[model samples]
Target chain A: MAKRTPLYEAHVAAGAKIVDFAGWDMPINYGSQIEEHHKVRKDCGMFDVSHMRAVDVTGKDAQPFLRKLFANDVGKLTIPGKALYSCMLKEDGGVIDDLIAYYFAPERYRVVVNAGTADKDLAWMRQQAASFDVTIADRPELAMIAIQGPNAREHFWTAFPAGRARTVLLQPFQAVEWDGWLVARTGYTGEDGFEITLPAAQAMAVWNKLKDAGVAPIGLGARDTLRLEAGMNLYGLDMDESQNPLESGLGWTIDLKDPKRDFIGRQALAALQPARQFVGLVLLDRGVLRSHQKVFAPQGEGETTSGSFSPTSNKSIALARLPVGVELGDTVEVEIRDKRLQAKVVKPTFARNGKAMI
Target chain B: MSIPAKLKYTATHEWAAKNAAGTITVGITDHAQEALGDIVFLELPEAGRQVKAGQECAVVESVKAASDIYAPIAGEIVEANTPAVDAPESVNKDAYGTWLFKIKPSNPSEYDGLLDAAAYEKVAAEH
Candidate 1:
């Protein structure tokens, strides 16, 4: 049986179409996914992200433990509630998972990881922390709700008025914790929003309040499209255990600033050179681009990692790992079934902040 | 759920109706549109293409995923629904009204082999 989140009842009440995703029974959409995508891009939309796991690493050795565990430097998080997006890597330089780590102090840091990789990630974290004086606590008791859009923050403030006072001035990539609520001004949709992690028992009430404040319930179907339009990578779709961050358009997330820092996968990453460039494709033809579609380019053959019809751009778009020689403005052919459809290469992002960048 | 009494349905979720022109017109069922969410694009079969029964000849893409529209029976494509192809969401709006393509059936009697409203409802329900 698939695991259900704390907001499963709320989702069912809201008439969501439920689908089993990565062992969790999650809402795919309340209705039309395109409408939900537009709602997040244009106005306020809330998502039940409770399936993601929150692991609290505490103790004197917490900072050092995370520094070696993630590809990004945890040392940069000097101020309280500063969040850093990083990729956790295996020894082979392949990505284990991408996560957001929020630092409160040297002794306490919270890392939120994807649902599908939770067990494997926890095992890896524990193995890495065996020598360090750290305590890894997987908080299954917590629930996450992400409210996003151009007008998301204001609506979130409207939903929980007292939350405004604490989180109002929080900058992008920052978080604020009070009582059981940890409101982070970070999201995967590339929009201005907050992802609130709170006590799981109180999730239904929070969802109700947010719904009452005109924050429409969005779902995974919209979430996928929204993130895709934002040029954000989906772990299983865009990159997996077999792929590295450099070829997955996540090179920026890997921190190499600290020369003294010897992290996992650093050797493999430093010694090896990447032959592929991660880029975006705008479908010039009248068909949708799906994953594993064979891409025919002048430089060499490439493959689409993630593909979708962008509601923001009103066109089919995709993220592809192509040969290094493929440049922007170059038109490539993608074979969808029998026909080779033309697509133009561009910067990996398609839209963000209620604007279509394509 | 709107399984029109006049039309026939395939287990794959496509609906077919004999038009006034005597050619069989095909479109996806309403249940299909609901399952697919929002229709984004339609890849219709060419006007002159030949197809066999249950042959996957076209595509109906939604925001979430792509689904194949199979030919109900063997026939030569007489006309592709240009307007519905141009605006695929029309099928979502009215699946029975927005036909995908028209096929001149190789055996017109093959249309009788298709499931009727009562039978299609069972198939739709099983999904």
Candidate 2:
């Protein structure tokens, strides 16, 4: 049997179509995926992201432990409540998972990981922390809600007016904790938003208040399209344990500045030459792009990692791992069925903040 | 959600409505459109083409995935809906009103062998 989040019944009451996602019964869409996708781009929409796992690592050894664990250095997060996006890798530079690390202090930090990989992440972290004097605890009692879009913050303030003063001055990637809730100015939609984590028991009440205040409930269908259009990567579909970040358009997140810092995957990444370049594709012909589609270019053969129709661009866009010589504006072809359709290479991001980039 | 009694349905989810001109108008059922979710592109059957029953002649790609539309009976294509192909979302809005193509049946008696609305409803429920 699939596990259900605290807001599952609320989604059912709103007539959402539920599907199993990472062993959790999650809403795919309320009615129309396109309509829901537009809602987030134009106004604001709420998503029940409670299925993802939050973990806390706290002790004198916490900071050093994280510095050794992630590809991105936690040492850069000096300010309290500042977050860094990074990938945890295996010893051979394979991606174990990508997560956001929130630095509350040198001794206290929190990390949120993808739902399907939560168990493995915890086990890995715990095993690695065996020699360190740190406590690794999973926050299963918390429920996460992401309110995203151009007008997300205003709608969020309108829902819980008391939070206005505390979060109004928050910058992107910053967070604040109050009333037993952690409110972060971070989101996956490439929009202005807050992902709030509060007590699971209070989730239904919080969801209801947001609904009454005009925050529409979105689902996984729109979530996928929005993130794809924003040029963000999905965990399992875009990369897995078999792949490394250098070939996944995530070299910026890896902190190579500290040559002495021997993170888990640093040695393997330094030894290997990246064979592929991560880039974006705009379909020159009419068709929706899907993941695992073959891409043909003059440089060599490549493949799309994740793809879909961009409602904002009114065309199909994709993130692809292509040959190193493939340049922007190069015309490539994608095999969509029995036919090869023309496409143009572009930057990975197609849209952001209510605007279409391509 | 709607299955008209006057029309016939195939287990594959295409609806065949008999026109007074002795031609069969074909569109996907409402249930099919709902399952597909936001039709984006369509490749309808071309006019003046001969197709046999269960032959895949049309392709409907939604925001979710692409699906094939098969011929309900052995027939020669009389006409294809150009306007519906241009605005594929019209199928999701009104599946019955938005016909994909019209079939000039080689043997009109083949239509009788197709499932009626009630029988089709039972088949749709299993899905």
**Which digits, one per residue and each the tens of the lDDT, describe model 1 over residues A88-190?**
9999999999999999999999999999999999999999999999999999999999999999999998988988889999999999999989999999898
Against the true structure, whose DockQ is highest? 1
Tell me, by TM-score, which candidate is best.
Answer: 1
lDDT of 2 by residue, B16-123 (tens): 988888899999999999989989999887899999999999999988788999999999999999988679999999999999999999999999999999999999
Expressed as tens digits, the lDDT of each residue in A1-358 for candidate 2 is: 9989999999999999899999999999999999999999999999999999999999999999999999999999999989999999999999999999999999999999999999999999999999888999999889999999999999989999999999999999999998889999999998999999999999999999999999999999999999999999899878889999999999999998988888999999999899899999999988888999999998889999999888888898999999999999999999988789999999999999999999
lDDT of 2 at A226: 95
**lDDT per model, in order?**
0.93, 0.94
**Model 2: how far is A192 from its true place, Å?**
0.2
Candidate 2 collision pairs: none
Model 2 clashes, total count: 0
Backbone clash total, candidate 1: 0
